[model samples]
Target: MKKIKTKEAVGHVLCHDITQIIKGVKKGVAFKKGHIVTEEDIPVLLSIGKENLYIWEKREGMLHENEAAKILYNICKNDYMCPSEIKEGKIELIAEKDGVLKVDIERLCKVNSLGEMMIATRHNNFPVKKGDKLAGTRIIPLVIEQEKMDKAVEVAGDKPLIKIMPFKHKKVGIVTTGSEVFYGRIKDTFGPVIREKLAEYDTEVLGQKILNDNPNEITQAIKDFINEGAELIICTGGMSVDPDDTTPSAIKNTGAKIVSYGAPVLPGAMFLLSYYKNTIPILGLPGCVMYAKRTIFDLVLPRVMADDKITLEDLASLGHGGLCLSCDVCSFPNCGFGK
Candidate 1:
């Protein structure tokens, strides 16, 4: 690119956008890239303090910032993600649907580590809504070497750096176990909480049964729900080691594979997780879930809704970020819980 005095550059093309700022009244591009510099435009350029402006000049092995930004966008954009118009050599990625955001951390780090360009994104595996800004990319200078962008793309490889997995519509069944609630001795707050939680993922509780702490009865209820086409089953209460707790036993009797009977997360340590017929997830939630606003359920539910299996190792990893601050006013999902 060639640089010339703003007053003498009447016919040259602008290589970069000259921004005009006026405190709260206005802040915008005074002369956009590729705009021909007419004699009348010289005064406008001087108003923005542009003593010298760059004119278009191509170099082999180099790319303009706008082109570099598009290359970065191409590497990160994927299904359910949309890119905004490139402005000021920057492009922002927005979510096309309400769903969970996934970022490939390793690749993202490698790309950012490459000098002269960057791509910043929202946290991975977090819930996001439509129109939410997921990521932004830009080149540091007016131009960057093409080799740098190629290296960034190579680090990103064929995998998408950002994606939104839409939540699935599944029929869920809830089996509330405990003698007090089964006999109406106490209000079943647990049932309602489980229902409300599932509803967040667009899952409907198709069938729910109130059963006392009887292994056989709990087993029968679970089998009934499966026969009724319940894709996910939840057995709340009776997961502890108390003599009357039989939810775990009942789930085992259903011949489902038990992933883990206990988790490392606080407020949900006694959580029981199992899978029926290798497809349906049956969770035996402890009493803590009824009162805690955020728990292991919040951490694991999104993965389930996205059809991602929660392996034992996955549950074990929750220990690092398991404890919730339990603020009086819960700001779950936005808080550190399950991060």
Candidate 2:
């Protein structure tokens, strides 16, 4: 990523109708920075006899065709009423490619009413600086006007709230380690269960491997996966305290830090969480991970694919609401607690 420049960089916009980009004219053209390109500017660029126009790097940051259009206007982000005056204060605004300005609530309204309204403004020729004055502040009259405004501004300051994005594109790997499972005493039911759960999210299984109960071999399998570009690793089976249960030891041998061992949740109480140095997650799921209707794996899959670093604290905190009631309805899609 390129970093935005300070005030010194000149911003330039496209000068011609290069959308079709006729041949013979070079693709990149250098122009003055901050030069607003209006709809009428297109004919002028063609008048100059230039077909293709693009921003080349300049001492001042060059403005491309898309970025230039977003500036040059005032926008309404939320529908709000201002009853008091505010000036010289900065309000965050989102600009679209068509020169529409989105007024951030910090500059337009108060926190209490932000959720209820999203109003648009049509102020053209609005001069804005990087962190410059957004708009004159105003207040909305209410029984508790001051409190309401405070809430509105606070809400405006934080436009979109952070959330645990569940179904993002992801690649998952599975490591099934257990002598009994590998030797076929138990059918490989864990693989199917894990696959079914992962399908709920936007994830693709890169691959899976089955190995005998050997911590060293399991550790090596996980390492091979990392070398092959596994983002999330799930190790199934052999999580009990038996001497044969070596998945945890093997994961530790790989130099990964265990986030939590044994959450308070049922069926999956022997689950393990660990992070490789690269922060790629390694999960040690119990035998129950294979067939439980709602194991701890079900509870944390979203957070895992969301790429969050699961901590012991996060697991400990789940004690209050982590218990899956296994409702017959299986209302998995809408429920937020498991996440």
Candidate 3:
């Protein structure tokens, strides 16, 4: 940094914020630090009682914050996401469509580990809307070393660190298994709960079947739904270890490869995940899902709607933050359940 006359500061980066005060009108920063001085800016500076100014001087191996911010933007941006205009050396990434936000957490951590540059994003695998702020990046100093920015770019790899996976409109099929609900001894509340959850992602329920605890009938229903073009199949209830429970066996009988018969999540420990023909996903939801406001289903539903493949390892890894607090007010997605 160096001090120079305002007249000679053209084309230089401002080293400090210039404030403008007008009673009852405005009193704030007129020009923020890191702003590039222009020929027209000299008169504004003079009017602000600036006969002399402090500005960044051109130096080797150093980049102004604005230039460094662009590097951060390029490292993280991808399709369906765009960066906002630079302001005070900061650039924010906005989602271009309603979809799930996918962030490469490992790559993002590596980039922020390098000093003088940083990137911050929303929780991964959460739903996002168009124009939502997904991430923000900036250079910490008014001037940063080009080598540090290059290192951050290197850590990001060839692909962008952040992406918005546009949600796919899937036709879902429901198979409510149990003797009570199937025989009308109890009201069927599970179907409505599942439909309301699906509505959040704009998915449609193609068809539904109420089947007793007969594995053969359950298997046939699943096959019929698949034949009718249902992209996702959800089997509710009868997933426990009881001998009478046959939902899991029925799903397996459909020739679907069972990924896992149980998950490590609370209020959803009996959750089952499988794939039909290695393509469409089949979920066996526990009874707790009908009563719990947030569960493992809420955690994994966004990825399923986004068409992101969920492997057995993905379900296993969710054990780290899979327990929902079951708060009375139920502030989820913003909670720590799936972070």
Candidate 4:
């Protein structure tokens, strides 16, 4: 760093903040550190009593922190995401649409491991609304070696490290099982809950079937919904491993490949997921989904709505951070229920 006349400092980066005092009115930074001096800023510097300023000398192989932040943004940007204006050597990514946020954990970790820079992001596979903050990027020092940022770009490869999978509008069907609701023994509460949840997405409920515990009837109901062009089918109740719990078998009877019949998540261990013709999804939700504030259903719904495939490994991975504390005042998605 070297001191130079404020008039000659134009285009040079400030090495320290220029404080301005307005007697009893104000006292604050008139020019922040790292601010590139401009012709228009000379008067303000003079008014702040700074006849000369210390500035960082431009180096051949180093990039300013703002430049490094843009490099990190490039590594993470994808469709359906927009970058915030670079400010104070930092940048943030915001979602341009409601969608599921997907993070490349392996690549993100690799980039962060490079050190001197960082990209902090929200948990993967979670839902984000338009304008929601997705990730932030910045460098540790006021300036960094351009070579380190180059290495980060190389590690990120051609594909970005983060993306927003936009939700697709789906035609859905609901199969409500269990004789208690089927025979009018109890008012159907599951159907309403499922409908309300689906309402959050761009989904059209094709129809819902109320059926007894009979496996054959349940299987035919699922087939009927598929034949009617339902893209997704949800089977509520009858997911437990009991003699009468036949939702799993009914889904299998449709010749749909079962992804998994169980998950490690609590309040949703009996959850079942299958795909018909390797396209349409059929889920067997546990009883808890009808009552629990947040279950495996809430965690998986965003991915399903986004038309992203769920695999056995995906279900197995939910074991960590899967248990819902069931706080008296639920703050799901924002909380660590499924993070």
Candidate 5:
């Protein structure tokens, strides 16, 4: 860093903040550190009594903080994400649409492991809304070695390390199973809840079928929905191990590959996930989803809606933060549950 007249500092990065004081009005930083002195900022600097300023000295093979931030942003950004303007040596990624956030955890770790830089992000494989903050990138110093950022690029490989898979429109079918609802012994509450949840996304309820616990009838209903062009099938109720619970068997009978019959999540341990024709998803939701404010269904719904395939390993990874606290005020997705 070197001191120079503020008039000659245009285009140079400030090495320290310029403070301004106003009697009974305001007292704050007039110009922040790392701010590039622009012609328009001259009056502001002069008003702040900054006759001379310390600025980062430009050097070959070294990049300014904002430049390094751009490099990090390039390594992390993908479709459906927008980058915040570089500010104070930092940049943030924001979602441009509702979708599921996918993070390349392996590459992310490698980049952060390289000292003096960081890429902090939200948990991977979670839902994000439009304008939601996805990740932030910056280097620790006001200037960084260009070669170090090159290494980060190499570690990230050809593809970006972060992405937002936009939710796709889907035709969904609901199969409500249980003899109680089928025989009018009880009202069909599951269908309403499922419909309400589905309304959150771009989904068309192709149709819904209320069937008894008979595996054959349940199996036939599922097949019929698929035949009618349903892209996703949801079976609510009858997911338990009880002798009368037959939804799991019914789904399997449709020749769909079962990904997992149970998850480690509380209130959702009996959750079942399957793929039909390796494209359409078939879900057997546990009874907990009917009443629980947040469950595994909340975690998995975004992925399914985005057409992001869920693997058994994904389900296994939920055990660490799978228990919902059932807080008096529910702030799901923002909380640690299913993270």
Candidate 6:
């Protein structure tokens, strides 16, 4: 019985008899480090509750649209989806081309049928570049199956998609227009809603003023708030195409440049946006946003706070998912179209 001591182990070929393993794994199979002994070396390596051992080579960066579609279509690769369940947003089929396939969303969603329905939600016709997360079909209800996801990627023959970024936050100001709120015709709810939503981000409330919709008063309010150190000034009400809708006039009177007078978004089509001397942002909110759960304000607030340059092209992009369906079940987190 010969024993290999620690001192003698340094310069020795302890196991020369071991063979170099060349096992065939599923094309895009992966395994984390410190995983348990493998039953077979064909697919991904399994982690034994210690998942930090191996570095999983995940697909990274933005991907092209056709490339993403191909990955999505591949969900039905080899495994035939039930033909009957092909409609009703369930059971999808994709054809392979150029060594790639699209992810199968409907079929994957139906087969699992327990967790939140996974969707390959992507940016709509917005000219996505290479290595972008075009569509993410969340099949395991809310949970994404890592293995299945990797296989899906392999079938798609593209890199992993990096998550899209959300708008950052900047200081904002609120100017509640209309004599109704000033005169107590209705307990002002708009101000608080705007405040709460903005508070959810990294922004500060620069200033606030409750003024009657008098053009001069509103105009002065805009100047005072801007002078008082407000970067973004939002004037609620007085946004309609009526005589009393003095918000537009007041903002213009402040010598502010109107970026957009009306957006195509529903419940907020009458919304207004302006830049005051290029130093501040002045917004005129329509009546619908006063009590509406989600409005144009919500859609544009993040962009304003992030100091993003909003263009006509950007506003035009909101049409695809701008209307709030007001579904019985609050599908906010599940759907980001309006947001």
Distance from true location, Cα of 87 in model 6, Å? 31
Better TM-score candidate (1, 5)? 5
RMSD of each: 3.4, 16.9, 1.6, 1.0, 1.2, 15.4
TM-score of each: 0.87, 0.55, 0.95, 0.98, 0.97, 0.54
Tens digits of lDDT, candidate 5, 66-125 = 999999999998888889988899999999999999999999999999989999999899
Q: Is candidate 2 or candidate 5 better by TM-score?
A: 5
Tens-digit per-residue lDDT, 244-283, candidate 2:
7888899999999877788977767898998899578899
Whole-model lDDT values for every prediction: 0.87, 0.57, 0.90, 0.93, 0.93, 0.56
Residue-wise lDDT of candidate 6 within 203-252, one digit each (tens)? 78886788887889989988887877777888888889888778898889
Each candidate: how many clashes?
Answer: 0, 27, 0, 0, 0, 35
lDDT tens digits by residue: candidate 3, 106-152? 99998898888898999887889998999999988899888888788
Alpha carbon lDDT of residue 242, candidate 2?
91
Worst 10 residues of 6 by lDDT: 94-103
How far residue 266's Cα lies from its native spot in candidate 6, in Å, is 1.3
Where does candidate 5 have its weakest 10-residue lDDT segment?
42-51
Clashes of 2: 27
Stretches of candidate 1 above 4 Å error? Answer: 5-43, 46-52
CA displacement after TM-score superposition, residue 77 of candidate 1 (Å): 1.0
Which ten contiguous residues of candidate 2 have the minimum total lDDT?
Answer: 81-90
For model 5, which pairs clash?
Answer: none
Q: State which candidate has the highest TM-score.
A: 4
lDDT of 4 by residue, 1-339 (tens): 888998899999998778899999999888888898899999988888889899988899999888999999999999999999988889999999999999999999999999999999999999999999999999998889989999999998999999999999999999999999988989999999999999999999999999999999999999999899899999998988899988899899989999998899987999999999999999999999999888999989999999899999999999999888999998887887777
Ranked by lDDT, top first = 5, 4, 3, 1, 2, 6
Q: Highest lDDT, which number?
A: 5
Better of 1 and 2 by TM-score: 1
